[model samples]
Target: MTVQLSGRLQAIADLVTCRAVLADVGTDHAHLPVWLCETGKIKSAIAMDVRKGPLLRAETSVRLAGLEDRIQLRLSDGLEQLRAGEADSIVIAGMGGILIRTILQKCPDRAASAKELILGPQSDPDQVRRQAQNLHFRIDREDFIREDGKYYPLIHLIPGEEEAAYAEEELFFGPCLLRDRNPVLKEYLLRRMRTTGQILEGLKKHSTESSRRRAEELGKEKRLLEAALNRYEM
Candidate 1:
């Protein structure tokens, strides 16, 4: 049998190297935990979800993988069922930035105990990064992956504050992605720049200052993106 995850989720799993157990919050199919345990990435893991339906699915997957003992399924909301220091690593994926922040806020102590945190928010990654920053979680690493025509950012963090603040440009365009200059990342940004430029052009027809300002920001992004592409080409 073969187990697989979306490219973004697999990238998240590849980011951290921890010897301790993992708690995959919002684990829908329990694939991440099962893969981790099956591949010896983690000794064991707890697959948790808010509802019973997904948890049941996770249970079945675990059983089919013959890992019922190694992968425990928990029915709880967010990290409510997880205790502080229960797991050294926590992974939260396939959720909105607001919900992810809410989960972290509800379990601030758990965040403190864990050595690493891997989060993949479906939207508004800047808001998520800001929340993590405010919580004194220093970014250990970040990656961007494309799957099903959508761009996903996988962020890893630890309990500490950043020495220097991240700029708006850095926040909107992931710092790691900007620095890495991966071809796929550049392609994604280029597409975004073009799409936003078109929107900005359309909004300019309405003659609103707010829209104009946003358009100008988008224009700047277009230029920045072009420069990044140029730099990468060189």
Candidate 2:
């Protein structure tokens, strides 16, 4: 069975440290697990989701791939269905950063038991990075991908002693990703540059304290984009 993943999630999948059993949280359609199985990278995987419809969709894919025995389909909310050490690694993708942080925070034990975590947050990436730091999960790698005119952030985190405090710039623009900036990453930075320029322009017409703060933020973002472009590959 050949499984296809969105370019962003495919990048995230590439960062996963393959283990005996992988659990994909919010496994919509279970494409990642199916891909791992087809590639023989993992012995088994659990495709878990909070919604039944998606779980059913994953079920269909598992059956189509003749992997029902190897892939387990479960209706689970966050990590509720996951017990400690159920899998060597966990992947939470295609979700917002806040929700992903909540899932990890609520199931610290479960997260701690896993050897690693691969997260691909669609939004609030800075928030996710901050929460990961707070949780003592060291980020081993970060990858950037753009698909369908949107940028995605993939982080590879694992258990370990806390490292040096991360700077605000590191949180907003990943250190690894910014340094290794590929063509897609360059495009993403350019998009952010344009967006921040627009925001700064809008602030000029709005005369208020909030507008002033926004203008300041836009300035910071513009500088960050420039630094990223200068320091990273184009």
Candidate 3:
């Protein structure tokens, strides 16, 4: 039987390039790795999670899928237990952007060795982009998915040299997604625009210096979102 993944996890799995040794960081149930392995997308995988409970769940899933030999379960904090050259591609998903950044920061050499880095940050995606750029991982592709009334972006990066710098809009919104003019991205931007407008309106009632500065920041962000939306003729 095939392992079923949620829309969010399926979106992340879809971004994985096939036929590589895969490592799924924070693999709560090891669903992604199991699906990939069971489907013959990848021959081997490392299913890792920080918490023992989650790792146990992953172990059970791996056993139930009859992929215990192919999918190795490890209790690891980020890439700490993983060595370089162990995995060709790494999937770090379902974590906050800041935590993801920290994971990459802690293991530069191991992370750089991977051919691909697929990241799904739950919050502060821009920070993830910035961190990846700083590590010289050029974004190969980006995708957006709306699941459970929430928007999530999947960033695919590869080790490469950067030819140019990303603008504020490109950094805030993914460069590939912006260029693709994804409808989901447009919807997300419009939602952000509406939220920013509300924040700006609330700031107007306060005359404090901090509120004024915050309002200015939000106004700038609102304009950026508007520009992005305009590109899609939305």
Candidate 4:
């Protein structure tokens, strides 16, 4: 039986360009790796998760897929147990952006050795992009998908010289996504605009210094979102 992945997970898997070996970090059910191997997209895979329960689930999935020989399961915290040059590409998905950033930070050398990175952070994508930039990974591609009333951003990064700089808007809204004028990105921005507007409305009720300061900051953010939205028109 072919393994089916959710839309978000499929988006993450589609970003995997490395055919030799791919490492799936925090692979809860090992679905991605099994799918990749079953489809002949990758020669081998190392499915690593921090928790034993999830790792066992991944193992079961791998075995059910009849990919026991091609996929290796491991329990690792981040990339601590992974060595440099072990895999051609690494995927860290379905985790908070801060935790994803921490994983990359904790294993800079190992991360740098890989040819590419496919990241899908559940939150704070800006932090993930900023950290990737600092680590000299160029943002190659970014795609947005709206699944089950949630927007998910998938980023593809490759080793390269550090980018010169990124505008605040570019950092928050992915640089490639903005440049490409992705329609889904516009949808994501519109949702943020609405949320921020609601926050601003709530802040207006209170005139304290802290509330006032927060209002000012959010006001700037709203303006930026408006400007970004405007780009779609022109």
Candidate 3 regions exceeding 4 Å error are: none
The order by descending lDDT is: 4, 3, 2, 1
Prediction 3 global C-alpha lDDT: 0.89
Report the candidate with higher lDDT, 3 versus 4.
4
**What are the clash counts of all predictions, listed in order?**
0, 0, 0, 0
TM-score of each: 0.88, 0.90, 0.95, 0.95
C-alpha displacement of 93 in model 1, angstroms? Answer: 0.8
lDDT of 4 by residue, 1-234 (tens): 458999998888889998999999999999999999988899999999999999989988988888999999989999988999999999998889999999999999989999999999888888999999878899999988889998888899999974468778777778888888999999889889999999999998999999999999999989889878877886
**Lowest lDDT 10-mer window, candidate 3?**
225-234
Q: How much is the lDDT of residue 159 in candidate 2? A: 80
Native-referenced Cα lDDT, model 2? 0.84
True-structure RMSD for candidate 3? 1.5
Residue range 108-205, candidate 1, lDDT tens digits: 88877888889898887878888888778888888888898888888898889888888665676666767677667788777977797788778878
Residue 135 CA error for candidate 3 (Å)?
2.0
> Relative to the unseen true structure, what is the C-alpha lDDT of residue 80 in candidate 2, on a scale of 0 to 100?
89
